[model samples]
Target: MKPSTHLVLLLANAASGMAVHDDCKLRFLELKAKRTHRFIVFKIEEKQKQVVVEKVGEPAQSYEDFTACLPDNECRYAVYDFDFVTAENCQKSRIFFIAWSPDTARVRSKMIYASTKERFKRELDGIQVELQATDPTEMGLDVIKSRAN
Candidate 1:
């Protein structure tokens, strides 16, 4: 896949307003955050095995504002940061694997619901390190690993 003109060749979390209907597979880490930002939308090109990372602006203080452009196609994933939040500040402020509902979305926010923050942090951190070490530019990592030349 040809990279986009505006594509930053760098880095990348969670489940939100997300429906449990689609068992969203964590697609290795598609992006890694080079600079700090509030929200992200990965426009996954499934056919081409590529993703376009969109670093969105913030005041991501509201759920609706944060999740307005969330992907529902079962391909791309969304991740967001909530470091600016202080009210119920506990641990995991990051959210990812945001699956949009086919019927009506049911994403879990750390702010609104009782959550498993550590697990999400572990996953996000691991992926961030993994991506930084070896950036996979294509979807054939498995195929290549299998010695399918």
Candidate 2:
């Protein structure tokens, strides 16, 4: 019999050797369900071979604060709860999954981040937008706004 699709996917994930910690999913649920946080920054712990939360933004935090949490020469994964007004003057919000791979980061770090991003993102259930950024300019507020619209 052929391997089931689910089995194949599970095997592929196991092969990657990177795990998303339980808290990562829990925090995402809080943001998605209760709106308790504005953003979450994730980092790969090379020693543990797991992805874990680095920082979390409070509900009152600004977008600039979220941007500041990302480092200048490192790779990170982040999720932002973006709130904006529509053209009709109605309130709207979007969950953005960002892969931050700055050009100056180590090649191995970037490669690992890139390869594991899809699998890691699957753990978050309600992500509405995805952005892969190589520099600050690529993920600037204007860029996120355009994508949200």
Candidate 3:
């Protein structure tokens, strides 16, 4: 007489993960929000080749007021959303655009207002940008050929 031993093994699907559906394929790099922090998002769609920018959480009110207060040709810092005269105040001022990285595709676009002149000077030295928001609820941005009068 001979005894036979049999075992059954089970395997899970390789694609399934938390919150991931079997039907939906894995996304390359998707933007995910963590905590709600006062930030801005700037987005440039490659497919459309269009630029859109907006602020999230809290509006840069201080920065807005500061820029608005500048007299004609008095804004020494570079302008992104608003158009200002650049003459005597700014000896060398230029707009800088930074491309999005693969991991940072979903980051919020924002610029913090420097409380002190030294902080403002530091900001001028390094111009950092975030992913522009596209949602209407966020912030509405119109691409104007010229700065709004």
- Indicate which candidate wins on TM-score: 2
Clashes of each: 12, 0, 9
Please, what are the lDDT tens digits per residue for candidate 2 over residues 42-149?
Answer: 999877988999999999999999999999999999999999999999999999999999999986677778778999999999999999999999999999999998
Q: What's every prediction's RMSD, in angstroms? A: 18.4, 6.1, 20.5
Per-residue lDDT of candidate 3, residues 83-146 (tens digit): 2345455433223222212222222111111111123223323333322222222222332212
lDDT order of candidates, best first? 2, 1, 3
Which ten contiguous residues of candidate 1 have the minimum total lDDT? Answer: 128-137
Q: What are the models' TM-scores?
A: 0.35, 0.89, 0.18
1 or 2, which is superior by TM-score?
Answer: 2
TM-score of 1: 0.35
Ten residues in a row with the worst lDDT in model 2?
6-15
Give the distance in Å from residue 29's predicted Cα in candidate 1 to where it truly belongs: 11
| Residue-level lDDT for 130 in candidate 3 | 24
Q: List per-prediction Cα lDDT, in the order shown.
A: 0.33, 0.92, 0.24
Q: Which of the two candidates, 1 or 3, achieves a greater lDDT against the reference?
A: 1
The per-residue C-alpha lDDT of model 3 at residue 63 equals 36
Query: Which runs in model 3 stand beyond 4 Å of their true positions?
Result: 1-38, 59-100, 103-149
